[model samples]
Target: MLQIQELVFDAWGRRFFDGASVSIPKDAKVGLVGRNGVGKSTLFKLILGQLTIGGGEIRLPKQARIGSVDQEHPATPVTLLDTVLEADVERARLLSDLETAPPERMGEIYDRLIEIDADRAPSRAAEILSGLGFSNADLARPMAEFSGGWRMRVALAAALFAEPDLLLLDEPTNYLDLEGALWLEARLRKYPHSAVIISHDREILNNSCDHILHLHDGKLDLYVGGYDSFETQRAEKLRLQEATRAKIEAQRAHMQAFVDRFRYKESKARQAQSRLKMIAKLPVISAVLREHTAPFLLPSPERPLAPPLLRLEGVSVGYGGPPILKNLNLRLDLDDRIGLLGVNGAGKSTFAKLVAGALEAESGEMVRSARLRAGWFHQHQIEALDPTDTPLDIIRRIMPEASEAQRRSRLAQFGLGVAKAETTVADLSGGERARLLLNLVAMEAPHLLILDEPTNHLDIDSRRALLDALNDYEGAVILITHDRSLMELVADRLWLAADGTIKPFEGDMEDYARYVVDRARAAARAPSQVAREEPPPPPRAEPPRKAKTPTGPARRRAEAAEAALARATEALAAIDQALLDPDVFAKDPAKAADLGRRREAAQARLAAAEAEWLEAAEAYEAVKEA
Candidate 1:
């Protein structure tokens, strides 16, 4: 369905695709795998015509439709169900044409609509939305009422509903919870059209994809079967390559030695010359370079904590209003590895906070050993990092009594080398920032570790490294993540947060996945029963959003803030691109240092611009509300 021949693309002072070529079979689900800095996303853009190729060609059928979710769906007045149903352009057009068409044309339109199963579009769209964590009530809600993240889900739902010939998804599971991720995995496996997904989630790649497309060192290698099979195939191919190169090198060396030994002899002169020529014609094989994954440092506690380190009896907790988690009775031992499962907004973070001592229980009894120490690491910690702050700066603050050398050494142990130690957080990749925070949180060797969505930013290899570190660390763990593979491998038991309470899950990860899929399917079927009881309202009859715009000072401030944010964002991207150069630090340390300083300044500007934008936007919304 999709083909690329010697495709070449270069931008931002580097080559992303250097004669990279691959073919995707029709209706094949392929996973694009690569390191963080690799050009997987760029490949998607090139295929989408958002980026021009420097050479060669990318080909698809003449009328092939391509679909991708570039950003969140726009906030509008359309009902969620109608928004997705409208994604079927052909169906929408035919239905619209039926309003004013002649009798002959009306028959054609109706026939086409029937062919496309237009009547079932609503049910299908609702199923997609339900699998993505939207409730049945959300179907009738205006798009303007949802948050940005929810809108992104709606965009994904639209793409899936349309079922274009070729679908491109970049980290589709990033915005989804574990339940949603599970549903998506099963959905992708049965997708009728071809799909190319860029995802670091192992379970998705293994379960959803039929093939793996690996991007490495400016080349693409297509492997048959899932991620595990791809790994095995790649390893064997490298081994064969190395063996061939060694044999060729030995032949060349022997020929050269023969030429050197017999060049002066009269009888052997012709033979020597012939050997030299033969040696010159020998093929040159480059050595394969294996990529390295930096190790994560998670130290174990100096002394083991007492068993039952934490116990809760009828514990209830909440911010101020009703309790998000009520009457929770649980116990944590020194050696337990507990996997916490829940959907978004399901009190998982609240439970983590309560255990981390960031929150106090509102009622009931909660007990903890006096010397118990807990290390909490969540995705929010990475978001809350100061853009201008460097690993060096952060380490210095934490180790005030230590010397500069000690601080640098500590940062190094956390996988931040000398070059990255002084670089600002804004210049670091998501994986780097995640690694720094993960190690920092576990630096003191707490008896218990509470990790939430820890693998969201990490690549497959980095995630494996983290899994290894977690396994080696001799401490109790409470792991909350959407990554099924990691959770299954790390956790010895399972706990689920649902229905405003926490309880022990009866079965394993596989059972949980089945349950989630079944639940979503049941929810999707529920809306139809309700429709039978009461007449369904037309989506178009729903109220539209109020058409109000900010005026005078509010409008002016918002426009200025938006402009400033654009400038700041562009400046930061340029600096980030420069810093991403592989030889930036090696070839010109001085230039790298200058870029680092500029990036720090740019980050500060970006932060200020974002804050101003948020304030202005809120004020403008307030005016509209008034």
Candidate 2:
């Protein structure tokens, strides 16, 4: 068992923890809950011996191995697979001994290798990497090829592969996509090791954790069951406390009234003196104090929005290379609550950039209504703040004409009141900085709000606030996030950006999750192998969109591609009928083989025709718009 007894800690002269004690039994999965900057990470550091404890003791088994996910991973030429495999120090040492050990000592090395499962270590590491959304090709690739977020994934994969006795993960789902997050949750649920995870995602916390550790006001309260159960218990406790407080107040009021009415009376003076003595003997209820749980609701737009706030016509957006989002045609209406779906590098961010006007299309045209006012909130924006500046300083720079009071009031809506507003960004927690970034965007009074992974830094309460605000907002929202609960709550429509095209998705996150997993597993497979696994493309979430009517080449090409698709479909059906005769394979294997080849060729042809049809269909639509 791991135990923290009378743990006392402080930072910058502020006591974050005082006499806090909690015990995590062996194999217990604990969801560490607290507001941002409440010392969850600090406690982890204390356990890791990275921070000096002010008082008390943290006890762990002497043999316990602790593994923690590193926040930052350096860009190195190290192969992704090796990076994960290297996490097992014992395995590395055993393998090294094999190279230098004498012939007689080779037996000892071999025995140690068996103990450590050295032979399967690399393959085990690979399996963990694949579970975290890395493809087979990605395993051999150097870490330097990946972005910072992806490098963090590599770090997580390494920690998971380490398989320590005690695991500490801080917001493990923040860098993952929907499929990856779900996969990680499933893995962690079956993990034999004890874990303490700090996460804003309620689903993950509830699914992966068996216990809840409520850390607040420098105290730790351990609760049984999942996060929902903890909430239920905490709510009931507060309700009862409130009722007791009300009763105490009523009793005190009655007693005071009696004293005030009868204290000076001759005969009743004895009763008044007795009441004062009774009041002195009563226990204090401590005022039922609670940390603020009220949400910081965001303000609505300042001006009415015109319909079709943004439109994309044949937009091809990418870096200085081939387009990631090709010939994209989309429209953002006043009521659009589009949840954009895609993998990490699948142009979701590029699409957001196209809508936010942060990146111009490499080709084609994007038209925005003159009345369009867009609020763009991306994770990078939070990191872009000047750390030396206070919230007041930042807002003053954004709105110099507004008075100090006005600035503070505006910031207060997003939970930065007078005291918090004056706090320097350098002293603020990551979640606070994230909120300040949103507050800055809210001040723009945007007609369209485009948020990309907005809940990554927020606590559960703040995420709830954001979902409520988005639900009640008058303007449209273009949301790109892996928060399934938020997406399910906020999104009225879903836009799927897959296979270099964008279209309305008619299903929910559940359906999208299955699709993502299917896609990821098949990503490294050749088309023929994928065809064998899945004979046809998955069913569309919605009915097939109508083909646009166009003049000239686009129209002609679309028609020709559709005809080709029909022919390919017909030929495949014929091949299927021919192959259906079991007698054919029994009578002549040569004929069966010939039919199989024909079927394969037909499938290849049909796939090509389908691709051409989709391309031509997009072109036809683009031309019609032109």
Against the true structure, what is each candidate's TM-score? 0.84, 0.76
How displaced is residue 23 in candidate 2, in Å? 1.9
Tell me which residue pairs clash in candidate 2.
none
lDDT by residue (563-594, candidate 2, tens digit) is: 78998998898689778767679867998999
For model 2 the local lDDT of residue 466 reads 79
lDDT of 1 by residue, 281-348 (tens): 98899898888888898898999876668989899999999999998888887767889987788899
What's the lDDT for residue 35 in model 2?
82
Q: How accurate is candidate 1 locally (lDDT)?
A: 0.88
TM-score of candidate 1 on Cα atoms, chains taken together: 0.84
- Hey, what RMSD does candidate 2 come out at? 20.5
Q: Who wins the lDDT comparison?
A: 1
Q: TM-score: which candidate is best? A: 1
